[model samples]
Target: MKKIIILLLAVVAFSFKTKAQTFHVPENYTLKEKADYGKYEDDVIKGIDWLQDTPWPLEEQKRMETNVFLMKWIQGSPTVSIEINGSVAKMTEKNPQLLMTFMGGYTKYALQNKTAFDKNKANQAGVKAVIDKYVVETDHKNNSLLNKLTKIDKDGKLADWMTSDFNKTK
Candidate 1:
């Protein structure tokens, strides 16, 4: 009976350890390297997985850095943008607030870096679709992120993009 109790305790401890795991970017990693394209995609997926499994970072700087890293990755590749859209859709049920936080970050990043983001129309459309689905499927009226986004996009360009036929054909 003592041995069985010990075994159960060990299993519980192991589960806690696994659940506490968080993803961290590798040291010296560069997002600009042409040869590290595969690694970039893997890191972005891992980051999303981390967001789903772990609580968000407590530090403001850490959160902003994470957002910037993800935005850069999304901007750099259409493949990665598609992957993010699918993953975010899946995340809606499990962690919708996190998805909202991510969308808010992406929106802010795009507005601040218009030149870089404007060149990636496909990625922008994909992100817009994800946001549109999120808004429709979730109670977004009270969501602070969505509220802030509406204010930031004063010219309605982002709204226009979200309602475009691009998502309809998807």
Candidate 2:
């Protein structure tokens, strides 16, 4: 009985250690970790697609579908490099701070079949268009919150407000 109890305790302790390791995100993980995260996100996208494609197991499908939609809204670092034509377009290399917010917003808007901004309804729009729509809306309504962060002074200097806000997040 003593040996059995000891073995069970050992197993439980091992499982706890493993679970902790699985969820660990180091403060300064290497570039390889970024690539791995991107791969996992790709897998999530594919899994969502597969779940949607299946015909049977309707309840399980519905559950996974819901979970996947929520997962899509998560703001993650830009690990996935998009390819335009044959060339790799690395947004993270250029602007790491703004990548997550912009990408997440564009992704949610694009994938949700939401209506285009009210210029011309007949044309489908991409990320640039979506960002333009956001900027235009902000301009038209003079969105105070966004303006506070993004506004430029008369001398073309950036607002001091967004300097700290955009600097340390990454």
Candidate 3:
């Protein structure tokens, strides 16, 4: 019985490990001209799961790339945005900093396309509400990220970049 239980546990653990490894952004992935929410649904869900379960990628380039990709995927439609927002909201206990990373992507995306982003009232409002919720729910005492988020919430913008001059560097 003990051996059988151990074997089952090992199998379950291995399956989870393999599942986590399966959903990374592909190297050839480029932002498509049009957002296809239906086509990328599974990838978006798995990517969010990975973000919630895994630590932020340590490499600067990899981190920024993943963040940008996630932002693009999640913002494909209002439905996708809601799903991603709910997942990130639940990350407050595990790693609230993920919210910062997610927002950083939004900032980068805006910088990349200022005109379109500025015109998108829905996107702007959604980002604002998320930032406000994060600031209210988390402790901001000496937490630089949370403090930054508070400012973003107030200003109705999120431009905190982990990398200096992301546009030039990339």
Candidate 4:
């Protein structure tokens, strides 16, 4: 009985059929044009973004443990999962006050774990593009919020995630 329930749930949770559930991520990322992510990087990025937006699957309660498996389904990259799990675990525990900060942390971790975290043309250009948009929108919001975002980069620059330059207008 337990096995059957688990099996049914496994199918439900991992179902790639967008109509089967609300787990679809059609516009998962803007990383499509970025070549460093490779030919199927767009697909992998979509899968990862899906995992990010959805509620935690009850069957896969220990997300940190299942990180490797999830990574495999998303083009077989474990590094991003490892860092995401760590960031999520930390944010869930250490600093609930920093939820927004942790949100950007996970994003940066995922992006930086890619081969393009360095000062390559793809990485540098991607960072600048993302940040410019972030600054404009953030400026309309609040500078204090922006400061908090930028401060969370204490972990690492990670090629200037949105949080890194949140203080530009400050």
Candidate 4, residue 80: Cα displacement in angstroms equals 7.7
Q: Which regions in candidate 1 have their CA more than 4 angstroms from the true location?
A: 1-17, 57-61, 82-170
Backbone steric clashes in candidate 2, count: 0
How many clashes does each candidate structure show, in the order listed? 0, 0, 0, 0
Best by TM-score: 3
Residues 49-107, candidate 3: write the lDDT tens digits: 45434434333454465566767765554432332333234433354454654453344
> For candidate 4, what's the RMSD?
14.5
Cα-based lDDT for every prediction: 0.50, 0.35, 0.49, 0.38
Native-to-model Cα distance after best TM-score fit, residue 87 in candidate 4, in Å: 8.0
lDDT of 3: 0.49
Q: Check candidate 4 and list the clashing pairs.
A: none
Give lDDT tens digits, candidate 4, residues 21-81: 4433333332323353454444444444443333343324333322333333333433333
TM-scores of the candidates in the order shown: 0.39, 0.22, 0.41, 0.27
Which rank order by TM-score, best down to worst?
3, 1, 4, 2
Per-residue error (Å), model 4, residue 168:
20
Between candidates 2 and 4, which one is better according to TM-score? 4
**What's the true lDDT of residue 33 in model 3?**
49
- Name the weakest run of 10 consecutive residues (lDDT summed) in model 1: 78-87
**How should the candidates be ordered by lDDT, best one leading?**
1, 3, 4, 2
